[model samples]
Target: MAENMTGDIISDHRERMLNLKKYYPFFRLIDTSFSNFKDGKYEILDMGYIVMAVLRFFIEENNFKEKDVTYPEYLDFLRLILKRDFGLDLNEQDSKEIADYIFDKIKNDGRPFEFSYFDPVDRKKRVSRMKIIESSIRDNTVWYSISPDAIEFYLDTKEIKDESRISVSQLLLEKMINSQNFRGGVEVVERINEEVNRLKLKKNEVLTILSGDVFAGIEAYEEFVKTGMKWFDDEEKLFKKNRDLIAKSIEKLNASGSTGEGYYRTMNEIYSLETQLKQAMNRHSELLKDCTEMQKMTDDAVRRAKLGRLRSHMDFTSALSDMIKRDNADILVTMLSPLLKPNIRKTFDLISIDDALMVKPPRYEEKELISNERPEDIEFEDEIEEKRIKDNYVFLMKNLIVCLKKSDIITLGQFADAMKRAYGEQILRNADFFSFFVNLCQKDEYQLGGDAGEDTFLDAYLGEGFKDTESFTFAIRKGLGGQVILSDNCMMADVELVRKEAHGE
Candidate 1:
C-alpha cells in the first residue's frame, strides 16, 4: 500500500510538470547551454548564450531591420562567434555538419524544470512568454529570424540603457496618445496605472527608510533634495503640457458636429486622456506634498535626536543633586555667582536712619478681592481665549494671502519660512496659527485663486494684515529657496491697501 501511494504521488507530480511545459514552451529553449548540466547527469543544458549571440548579431550589425539570414550566412556567423568568443575551431568541420548540430541542439532542448504562472485574465495556470526560435526557407535557401515571442523575451531580460531612459515619461505620453485604437487602449491605461503604482511604492520606500534613520550623510541628503526638486520641476512641466493637450482636444471635440464612429471614438479617447491626465496630475501633487511633509518630519526628528545627545553630554542635574545631598551649599553658591547679588561695603549705620522713620500708613481705598467672582461687564475667560485664537488665525490667513499675492507662486515650506523671518517667531511658532495657514493652503478656492480677481480676494479690504503703513502694505512674501515653485492655483495674492478707502481720508 505504501509503494502504491508513492507511485501515485510521483505520477501527480509528473502530470503537473507536463501541464506547465505545455502552457509555457519557452522553457524548452532555456536548457540548451552545454555548461548548464554536469557530467553524467540526465539534464538539459542552458541555451541563453545562443539567444545572446542572436541579439548581438542584430545589434552590432544592424540586421534587425533585415530580419532574415541565408543558411550559409547563419552558419558562418555562428562559426565566427564560436571561434572568437568560445575559442572553438570549427574551420575543419563541414558547414552542413555545424548547421545540423546547432539545429539538433536547439530543437531537442528542454528546461531545467517546468515554470508556470497563474493567468489572471484567463483565470487559469498559464505559462510565460515562450517560443525562442523562428526559421524558414525560400527557394532552397534557409532563412533565420527570432520569432516575435523570442524578441519579447530578449527585451524583457535585457537592461535598459541610460540613454534609452532619457525620455521615458515622454514615451509614455506618446503611447497614451496613440492608444486611441481599440486594441491597445486598455493596455495603455494599465501601463499608466502600473507606472503610477510604482512611483507610489517608491515614495513609500523612501519615507520608510528616512523615518527609520535620522543621521544620514550630508551628501545623501543633498542629493535627495536636488533630485527631488528636479523631479518635481520636470514632471510639473510635463503635466502642464498634458493638460494643454487635453484642453485643446476637448475644444476640438466640442466644435466638431460629426456623429460618425470615428468622431465618437476620438471623443471617448479624449475623455480617457482627460481622466488619466487628472490622475497623473493629482499623483504628482501628492508626491510633492508627501515629500515636503516627510522632509519636515525628518528635520524635526534629526533636530530632536541631536538635542537629546547634547543634553546627555551637558547635563548637570545629577551634580546639583549630589551637592545638595552633601550639604555643599557654599560651593553651589560660588558656582552660581553670576546669578547671586554682589556684596557691598557698609555706607551707613542702621541707627542713623531712626529720625527718618516716619511711616504713614499707606492711604488705602476700599477695594474688592476679585478672585472667582463673576463680573457682568467682562467676557468669560474661555470666550476671550477662543477669540484670541480666532483673531490670530485671521491675522495669519491675511498675511499668507498677501504674501502669495506678491509672488506668482510659493510652496508651503517657503511660506512658513517667510512667516518666521518677517514676523519673527512670534506667530510661526504658534501651533494654532500654523495650522490655520496650512488649512488655508488646502482650500480648493484658494488653490484656484491665482487668477486676476481671485488673487486679490485676500487683500486688505478683508483683513487688517494688509493695512497701509506708508503708501502701501509692504507685503512680506517668502521665497522657496529656489527648489520647488508652488502651483499657480495654490499661490496667494499680495494686496496693497490705501488709507483713503477705509476712513474716506
Candidate 2:
C-alpha cells in the first residue's frame, strides 16, 4: 500500500510538471533565445543580463511618458551598458541586432520568464513569471518598460542579505526633502503615496524578521535588535529634520504664499508630508518597542535552554545513582534533601495507641526483642530539607503598602529606594519586582490621588529611566500635577505623591 501511495505521488508530481510546461510556453522561448548560436555572435546576449538591463531602464525612466523608451534609444542604452560594463566592443548596429532578436523572442513567448519562489503557505516551490511589456510605438521606434507584475516578482524572489538591507523610507524621505518641486502636482503627491506604501511594506518586513521557524533563534533576535535600533536612530533623526523643514515650509506658505489652486495644493503637500513623517516616527517607536520585547523574550529562552542542560546533567535519578556508586550513607540525607518533608502525616493502622505503646519481650527462640515507642515526634531541622522556595510576595506587598500609605503616592524609584532601605537590595534585585508592583497598583484596593470631583488614580507614565530604576514616571492617580524633571544619564522617572483630602478642619 505504501509503495502504491508513493507511486501515486510521483505520478501526480509528473502530471503537474507537464501541465506547468504546457501553461507556460514562455520558458521554451527564453531557452531557445539563449540556445541559438549564429556563429557565436549573440552569445553575449545573456538572458539574465537582458532582464536586468530592462529592469534598470524602467527604474531610471520612472515617469509614465519616459517609461516607453524608443527602440533606437533602448538600443543606444544597451550598447553603452554592454560596452562599458561588459567590456564588449559591440557597436550600435550589433547592439540593435541583438536587442531586436531578444525583443522578438519576448514578443513570441506570449508569457514571461518564470523563476522559482518558496511559497511559505503551501510549503513548496512555485514559479513567479517576469516580463517587460512593450507600451507604445512611434514611427519606427518601439517604447517598452517593465510590467508591474515583473517588477513585483523580481522583488519577491530576490534574496537580500543584512548588509544590503537599505531603508527605502529614508531614501524617499531624503529625495522629497531635496527636491525643489516636490509639491508641484498630482504626480508628486502620487509618488509620495507610493513611497509611503513602500515604507509600510519595509516596516512590516522588519516585524517579520524574527518570525517563523526560519528565524526563531537567538541569532535572529540579536540581528533584529541590532537592525531595529540602528534604523530607529537614523530614521528618527531624519523624521525630526523633515518635520522641521515642513514646519518652515508651512510658515513660509502662511506668511505670503500662492492663491486659490496653488494655495490648496501647497497646503495639501505640507499636510501629506507631515502625516507621513508622523507615521514613520510612530512605526520607528513600535519597531523599537518590539525589538526590546524580543530581547527580553530571547533572554528568557536562553535562560530556559541553560536550565534544560542543567536538568539533563543533574536529575535526582542520576544523583542517586552516583550516591549508590560511592556508597556514602552519610550523604544519604543530603541526597534526599529535596524530597524530605517538613512534616509527614502518619497512616493509622488497625493497631491501637496502647498496642503501639506496649513493649514486647523476646522469647528464647526469637532472634531479637521488639521495643515500641511512639517515635518521639522527631523535628526535621531548623530549616526544612524540602527545598521549598520561601514566599516573599506577601512580605513585599505589605512593605510597599506601608510606604504608599506613608506617602500619598510614590515613584517606582522612590519605592525601590524605600524597599532597599527596609529589606535591603536583595529584595529589590528581583527582576520582576517592578512588573509585579505595576500590576498591584492596578488592583481595586488602591485608589488614585485626585480631588473628590476629579478622576485620577494610581497610574504610570512611560519614560526613559536609569538602570535599576523605573522606566515610567508614576503617581498615585491624578497626583502628578506639575512638570516632572526627567534627566539624561540616569533617566529616572519623576515621582509625585498627592495628599488625601482632609474631611474636616
In the order shown, the candidates' Cα RMSDs to the true structure are 39.6, 40.1
Instruction: Write one digit per residue (lDDT tens) for candidate 2, span 292-364.
Output: 7656766666677667666635476877787799987676677578687565777874335424543346657
Each prediction's total of clashing residue pairs, residues at least 3 apart in sequence or on different chains, is: 13, 4
> Using TM-score as the measure, which candidate wins?
1
- Candidate lDDT scores, in order, read 0.50, 0.50
Displacement of the residue 217 alpha carbon in candidate 1, Å: 7.4
- All candidates: TM-score: 0.32, 0.31
Candidate 2 CA-lDDT value: 0.50
* Model 1 alpha-carbon miss at residue 291, Å: 4.9
